[model samples]
Target: MLSKSQIKVITRLKQKKYRVQDGLFVAEGLKVIKELLDSNLELHQLYTTVSFDGNLDREQRITEAELKKISFLTTPNKALALFKIPASKTIDSDQFVVALDSVRDPGNLGTIIRLCDWFGVKELICTTGTVDCYNPKVIQATMGSITRVNVSYLDLERYLKETRSPVFGAFMDGDIVYKTDLPTIGTLVLGNEANGISPEIEGLVTNRITIPRFGALQAAESLNVATATAILLSEFKRKG
Candidate 1:
């Protein structure tokens, strides 16, 4: 049974300020909560509607009706957990890493995080303006991979310059992604939703790349940031 104080705490977590203050974030769904337990992130509490065999510090199996009271998910998943957002470490230049340049939209950010985990890209460096890694929407979209990857919000430009690895940028009219040679190491800079790559970052880009478009079909400006990221990651991993 959830205490009145516990209810208050969970309700407060919906806001970013409280999350930051408590140094904890929410992850919903069986997959995410299970993966969170498996990952390095710490599980503060596990609220479930059913019995869970997975390792947990404190597990409360509430009713489906009770779950509706606490869960932020549209359909209360089997489990929901609160975890501490782990601070990401510095980039190891020798290994492949991704850097985000103010990529907004929590879902997009989450998708990118999942991509990083899938590609085995351990380090993700984000500009100061990028969305918070622990945002619920981003966490939701990341499926369960959020636990497997280390996401760091940092001065991307400074890191890029200091690391000076084979920094690559994705642009609309840039070189073909398939045709261009992509280095395994260095930062892959993904820009904001509408504004592609920022002028400041374009200067830092050692390699400019674009996903090849297909047959003549007058469509929207370009692919969504998440889709673009998936393609880019696939190509880089495929090549190197």
Candidate 2:
């Protein structure tokens, strides 16, 4: 039987303010919860309708009716787990990095994190205005890749200014990424959905690169930020 207080706490975690205050976040589904359990993140509690084999110290078996009440998803998965938000590590300058300038979509941010993992990019830096990586939607979109990638939110402009490696910003008017020689170690900056890179961050970009359109008319205004990130990461890795 789930207690009222437990239900209330789980419901509050859906909001960013409460999540921040508690320093924890909720992950649903068997796969996501298992992946998080295997990773370094500490599990605060696990509430499940089905039997799970891993760490039993904090496990609670709950009924489906109770699960439906606490779940953020329209259709609740068999399980939901609360995991401690790990501390952000210092930005490592040795490897290629990806930075975001106010990208607000949770799905975009999640996909970008997965891309970073797939492409071997070590760290993802996001501006304060960017969507929180811990947002439930973002975590769901990421699947299990969130555990493999390092995401840090900070003042992107200041971080750009201080970075020793060259900074590359994605722009429509910039040199074609395929034609440009990308360095192995540099910061690839991607901007917001509607707006491109902000003026302040753009000023810090050492190089501006673009993915060219192959179609005859070139009618598309811009690539989706996550798609743009995939292409850019491939180019950088290919050249390096």
Candidate 3:
């Protein structure tokens, strides 16, 4: 059973201020919760509907209806966990890194996080206006990849200008990525879902690259941001 105070904490996490103040974020679903338990991230509390043996001993096995009451998910998950927001690591430009320029959708951001983890990319750079990585939707979409990826919010344009490494931006009119030369160590910039890359950072791109389009030319504008990221990252991996 959840106390009124605990319910308030769950509600408070929905707001950014509370999340920042507490330095904790919620991770939903049994799979995500399990991954968080195994990772170096600390588990503040565990809310679950089933029993399992893992790193946490301070878990509560609430009823399914109780989980629904507290869950931010559309369909309540079997578990919800309060995890310590791990300290952000310093940006390492010595290897392939992804820079997100205001990717707004939580699902798109989360899928990118998963891709970064899958591709062994350790660091993610997000512009200040990008979607909160800890947002419930992003957490759910990451599907446990959140535990492995390090997402840092930064002044993207300034960082791009300061770093000596090559910066690549994905745009429709850019050079074809499949035929272009990709560097082993640099930043890849993916821009906003609707607005595309901002003009300030547009000039920061050392190489403008685009994924080749094929098949039906239905007036579809472009691939979704996450799909574009997968395509770009896959091409980079091919170079390795």
Best model per lDDT: 2
Candidate 2, residues 5-32, lDDT tens digits: the string is: 9999999998899999999999999999
- What would the per-residue lDDT of candidate 1 be over residues 1-240, giving only the tens digit for each residue? 788888889877888888889999998888778777877777788888777885455887777877788788788888778888676575566888888899989989998998998899998888878988787888898988877777887777777777757888999888998888877777788999989788888898888889878847785668999999999999999987
Give Cα distance to truth, residue 72, candidate 2, Å.
Answer: 1.2
> TM-score of each candidate?
0.92, 0.97, 0.95
* lDDT per model vs. reference: 0.84, 0.91, 0.90
Against the correct fold, how does model 3 do in TM-score? 0.95
What is the overall TM-score of model 2 with all chains considered together?
0.97
Backbone Cα, N, C clashes tallied per candidate? 0, 0, 0
Ranking by lDDT: 2, 3, 1
Residue pairs that clash (backbone atoms under 3 angstroms), model 3: none
**Sliding window of 10 residues with minimal summed lDDT for model 3:** 51-60
Task: Report the lDDT of model 3 for residue 68.
Answer: 86
lDDT of 2 at 191: 97
lDDT of model 3 at position 151: 92
Regarding lDDT, does 1 or 3 come out ahead? 3
Q: Which stretches of model 2 miss by more than 4 angstroms?
A: none
lDDT for each residue of candidate 3 in 128-191, tens digit (9 for 90 to 100): 9999999888988898888788899999988988899999999999999988999889999999
